[model samples]
Target: MCMPMTGARRSTSFLLALTTAAGASLLTGCGVLPGITGGSREPLTVMTWAPDGTQATNMPGMPATAVAFSRWVNDNGGIDGHRLKVLTCNEQNTNIGAGNCARRAVKEGAVAVVGSYSQFGSAFMPPLEAAGIPFIGGYGISGEEFTSTDSYPVNGGQAALLAGNGRQLARDCERVALVRPDTIDGDDLPPLINSGLTEGSRHEVADIRAADDAGDYSSVAAQALERAGAGPGVPARIGRSAARQQARKGCVTAVLGERTETFLDSFRRVETADQKVRISSVVGSVGQALIDSTGGKEGPFEGAYVTGWYPESGDPRWDAMRRVVDKYAFGDNRIDTDDAGVQTTWIAYTVLKQAVESLDKDSVSTRELAGRLDHGQPVTTGGLTPALRWDFASMLASADFPRVVNRSVTYQVVRQGRLVAQRKGFVNVGPTLENARTSG
Candidate 1:
């Protein structure tokens, strides 16, 4: 027969069992107990860098848009239940600053850099490649953005825009004069424009180079007008008659960043009634904001032809982006609803969200994120861009820009102080870009 234990001994045994059960619960909460549930989710980290308050090409809206997007996402349950941590850097429009921003992103463990603007791609891309971080939705100012294996550009950069502009002008103008910055970066503009003009069976443009930051462009403007052989100024009715007499109407296309406005200012002052010169430009070099600031319908850009990567800012497709700016931006002046840099940032984050959701695990690293994008995932941007895919099969065949997947641009014109679509659809410049690569 077994004897019963004392009451004090029974109490001590019961207390020991309770303590062991509590220890197991604590371990599971801390992720020490694996195989039952996945580890605790880690927040996703991203970096966005742009130049603000710089003497040349300031893109303050890019980083500002990135911050606003993070807030909007976090407020609405974040991407796949993982909190987004956006670290912003001001590149200060210097090569050194761009490299430093890349180094910081690597040191802080950012999986990707999205929707940023930096002309110093050569300086920054190396650091990101070394860390295996994907660069997505960049401003596409640098040729490296199109060439880097690590870069997933959302748009076709300047190459496509310039080529498309050439095609647009070819239909209307007999002679085209391209006024571009005289810099190492601007060297690539002529060949790309020539390719498009050639495809349209038009003669090559008269390529004129000017200082990017010149205080005045009177001489350059006068020279471009003279080369185009514009006639003397006359009344509107008389000008139309004079234009018909001329064998070819002249078109002047300016691609100087920021200084395009100043160039136009000088151009208008020297313009004669008989000149009948039509001004044309790419979208980044001219926009609604510039038109409004310069004088709307009366502005020098009136009747200008422009090529852009997306639909007009007033289109209904941008309604979703405008709502985010309305709510989370809280009237922040830097975040303009129509700014291209801001639009680019919004699209970049959309890509990031889609990429993160495709992951099997809640927690991801730089390598895993980049690998997912490289594996031929198609990301849709609600009609903001063609479905973006970075696989080799989806990329353009150009040897110089093997990574460029979007070769589409829209033709637009300034009318009644608003940018309206001249054509209802996108113009394909892939053939022109391919020809450029092979001809060289």
Candidate 2:
């Protein structure tokens, strides 16, 4: 007793089938919803925010990477069968904007805020702390991230980099000069850099401050070169003549964030063949993309010294992260695997995943997740970062950064326009930090 097949009925049936498949894909692709078959009753919600489309210091990739991580993990049955949701916000590089993002997380019942970036930690950290939510793996831009009890930083913040950079430059350059932004946050940079320089028995760094966002850095560049003991009139090597006595090898390190490139451009223009001063910066200021853009082997960054939290972009340890980006975030230009923000986001999510998986319950609350992290669960980042655990003993003894658990940095140098490993492995800057704490 089958009805005769009609063209109209066939079209309707096909449409219904397509709709069903689309619904299933949406549920399983990025996140499974509560009450969906095989989904846990309690869903996990998290937020990731960064300045986007702002005048200065934007990190849109941090949030974008969060989205991609959600999609990839959900596709593979989600994190421990619990539905995972990511809420992203734009901080707009303002205090009010950062506060707004933090308030939104509180309103939305986010269990955690992971891998975010903001210089206004004063505005943001309060809300997360009040709500008893943990902040994990922030981009290390704000000082409150280190002092807040609820924060679990994966890497030592900017303090570690300046110190590490000083240490790296100390080996070869007898005189080192630092050019950094002129801002409230920038005030702390000089002391940290000096700590490392003095640790290596080198003279303290000459602090040179400049506008954070300037169209020209000619004056600044000239001043830096002059102070670093690099000049066109002096010979590259020490000579017997009194005039050549000023030829002491020098280096200038800049930490102007995005404007580092602009400063370097001006520095190159002012540079003379007789000047053998080396250029230096930390990872966030210089990376593979910048080097490639400047023309590989012929780039201005060639022979420049760089320090970073992770390995060089070409290292084999990053193979697993590369595969994830390829499988999930392919062609998504916002999520650059080489980007430090994106890499931090990936590692932050890995910690969250491990935290959730460790609990044996079908439903989880923010307190439960935070408690798991608080009890010192070791998180493995596939060798991206050192094994991370946050116990009382693990906290750094430093006054400003007591919550920092990982104080290691890698030394890298630009060779033929590519960032290569300058040191074999992570350089332990813990002693320098402790020394700085005691001395300061």
Candidate 3:
């Protein structure tokens, strides 16, 4: 009810307001500031990053799944009533884009980067490492995920998938061809698949490298068919049916992430009934969802072999996650429950929640979370993964991928358009990897 005296009072008032607002902003950008902190009786913040809407490989489902998990947890009392704040970034599948996302996570005060995807580990790992931020449940796309001290991978990453695929293929195929990306990460794949092949006394894989983002893989498909089907060591072709061909003709397995479908399309076009070879891929590159979209029983993937880090999407272990998605992330089309990325994100978040819950407090530091996980904490993911424990003693005996703890992979095959288990339960490929490391 007092009248302004004009200039001096108004100017002073404005300056004071500006000062207060600036202070608030400073707090907002901190990794843990005031109410929104990794402290007791407070909210926790984390990030999930992945490439989306890119020309090359993309996993829109990973970040989308993280968003869904945040929505679900926050709605359901939020990890012991401390709300979960998830910040998602699109890495755009570039080195700079990955670095930028990591920097953003650091600036925005994320306690951890959880259940994310990026093949460019060399780009993103540095920022998080410098900030001492933990990376939990990454999609395991890069070698750095296995080597970096900050990374706590939920699965054996591509190493397990390829090695498992090798073991799976070796059991049946007369010859093996691996079509992988020509990137640095792709270089590591051949040795892994070979390790599994060695276990079954099969010959080394015919390593074929291709562009990850190619629009046309017809030539590559032709090459794969020739190398795998007519490679030097293969027996003279005598079979026609897929089942018969796999054991006599050969097997061609591609691990080209999102571009796998394109490769298969090319493979299908060049392939005739008499020239058919057994098709195969790891779970992240292929799943039931892809099988359905391609033509089910009549598709190229109808008789393909696929190796996975977890049970197939239809397993009852995923019921709880499905329930959460149906309740909170309803109609979010980006989330395909069958997607390996979506499943990884769900499990990664589950690990994070369990680590946080173990603290039994609202406040958590990056050290606290990492410490709890590193110190032999066993997280049960409702059977989504073999109860994961990342203690040093539990890790595998490989110098290349020493941090690997859960080295189990499921061997699956497409039957009647569905990716069902080829063999019952999880297959332990630790010895295969260990052998590969020794031979390398």
Top candidate when judged by lDDT against the true structure: 3
Q: Tens digits of per-residue lDDT for model 3 on 157-201?
A: 899998999888887786888999998888889999998988774
List pairs with backbone clashes in candidate 1: 232-274, 233-273, 233-274, 234-273, 234-274
| Residues 1-440, model 2: lDDT tens digits | 22333598856754664479774454455444433444545668999999988656678888988988888877776778767899999999899999999999999999999999998999999999899989989999888988898898888889889889878877777788899989888888888888888866457788899988787899999889887988456543543232323443688899998788888889878877666577789977877888888776666667888989988888888887788888887678887788888888888998998888889678877788778887846888888889998888888878887877889999998875788999888998887776664222
Model 3 deviation from native, Cα RMSD in Å: 8.0
What's model 1's overall lDDT? 0.83
Q: Which ten residues in a row have the lowest lDDT in candidate 1?
A: 31-40
Candidate 2: RMSD to truth: 7.1
Backbone clash total for model 3 is 4
lDDT of 3 at 59: 90
Output the better candidate (1/2) by lDDT.
1
Model 1, stretches more than 4 Å misplaced?
1-39, 236-248, 437-440
Give the local distance difference test score of model 2: 0.81
Model 1 lDDT tens row, 1-440:
22333599756654563479864454445532233222245778999999988766788888888888998887766777677899999999889999999999999999899999988888999999998899999988888898888999998988898888988888777678899988777888888887787765456888899998788999999988987667555556643334433433788899987788889998988877767687889977888899899888766666789999998898899999999989998888998777778888899999999998889567888888888888846999998889889987888888777777988899999887788899987888888888774222
